[model samples]
Target: MNKGYVYFLTNYRRTTIYIGVTNNIHSRVWKHKLGEGSLFTSKYKLTVLIYAEEYDNISDAIAREKQLKNWHKQWKWNLVKQNNPKLEDWYDTLRGW
Candidate 1:
């Protein structure tokens, strides 16, 4: 099975959060940072990587992404706070991988 990743992204204002699933978190997040990921992300400026999870299978990652997308806005933020209380941008962590 291929490895996969699910991640959450937000902007400085934290007004909007974007969730995604990818086989390569580094490349996908890099595209998002460059504003080439999606129309919604670009419009909302959600470039900060705040939360992420890895799965052994792409299907699992996709299912998790679907679940997160269906969650309430506050619920998603709450999840982020659980792991990232400060809600800091974790983009820099992808380096040297």
Candidate 2:
């Protein structure tokens, strides 16, 4: 029974956005930071994790990721702002988790 996560990543300039789902947020994020996650993420340099939501079911996490991907850019940005006003890289916070 693995938990899952839906996360948002943006570049340093916060100009590009990427959304993804994973059963292990830490390792997945680490790969993205190293520019090995996906061609889209690598090309856009979307390494900073700005928002994340946990789910008990991986299917739910995947569904949520799909939903967010279809959302308008402004809507996505607003969602990130609601959860992370500062839009800080959340990788450091994962250390305590």
Candidate 3:
């Protein structure tokens, strides 16, 4: 079975947060960077990936994406801070396929 990823993307100013689920993180992120990923991402120009969670199954990733989406803004920030204290862009860290 294909693995899955639940990830968070934000703008340079950290003004907007976008949660997404994907089977291939690199391809999805690359699309987001190119402004063709989603309407919200394109409208907000969100390309910085701040957080990501990997799962063995796509369904689990989708469920976590839904959960994070329902969280409050600050709560989401705190969660991201826990793993990524600097809140830095994670795009550079993604492995090339």
Candidate 4:
């Protein structure tokens, strides 16, 4: 079975946030950073990965992404903070994965 990833992205100012899921987190994030991922991400410059969760099933990853998207902004922020208290970019962690 294929695995999946659900991730949270924030802009440099940490004001904008985006939630997404993909089978390839590294490639997807690379596209977003290069301004070729999604219109919303490119428009908002949401390229700093703050949080990510792995799932054995792609369906669960998609569902979690949808659930996070529907959550309140504050709730989403809290979730990110819970995982990444410093809110630092985590793109580097994708290396060797």
Candidate 5:
């Protein structure tokens, strides 16, 4: 079975949020960082991976992505804060991959 991921990206300092799902988290994030992803993310400059959840099924990841996208901004903030209180830009972390 293939793995899928539901992830949230934020602008520097967590000013904006974007939720998405992808089978290749690394490549997808790299695209966002390069401003080659969605227009929304590129316009907002939300390239930091603040939170992510892995799923064994693509359907499950898509469902989670939809759920997160529908959440209120405050709710999303709390969710990201729970795991990434500092809201660090994760792009550098993936550089060694």
Candidate 6:
């Protein structure tokens, strides 16, 4: 099965948030962490994966990413807190993938 993902990354202090969708979440996040991803991610140093959701379809994942991107900062904060109250860096958890 093809998998898609919607994920969020933040800086060290959780001061910045980036929402994106990718078919290969691990690879995509790795690239971002290594500063080999988009200019925005690299410039902002957003390398900590704080939140993620998996999906079976790319379109749905893309739509969710777009929706989250347009949400207000506070709304996004609540969403993240619901799943990850501490907003801990999830990079290690994804390493085995």
RMSD to the hidden true structure, all candidates? 1.3, 0.9, 1.4, 1.0, 2.0, 1.5
Candidate 2 C-alpha RMSD relative to the actual structure: 0.9
Residue 88, candidate 2: Cα error in Å is 0.6
Listed in order, each prediction's TM-score against the native is: 0.93, 0.95, 0.95, 0.95, 0.89, 0.92
Off by over 4 Å in 5: 92-97
Error of 4 at 67 (Å): 1.4
Which ten-residue region of model 5 has the weakest summed lDDT? 88-97
Global lDDT for candidate 6?
Answer: 0.90
lDDT of 5 by residue, 1-97 (tens): 6788888898886777888899888999999999998999999998889888889989899888888888899999999899888988665675543
Model 4 error, position 15 (Å): 0.1
Instruction: Tell me the tens digit of each residue's lDDT in model 3 across 1-97.
Output: 8899999999999988999999999999999999999999999999999999999999999999999989999999999999999889998888742
> Residue 3 deviation, candidate 4, in Å?
0.6
Clash pairs detected, candidate 4? none
Alpha-carbon lDDT, every model:
0.91, 0.94, 0.93, 0.93, 0.86, 0.90
Worst lDDT 10-window in candidate 6? 88-97
Please report the candidate that would top lDDT against the real structure. Answer: 2
User: Once superposed on the true structure, which residue ranges of model 1 sit more than 4 Å away at CA?
Assistant: 95-97
Q: Give the count of colliding residue pairs in each prediction.
A: 0, 0, 0, 0, 0, 0
Instruction: Output the lDDT of residue 18, model 6.
Output: 90
Model 3 bad stretches (over 4 Å): none
Which residue pairs of candidate 6 clash?
A: none
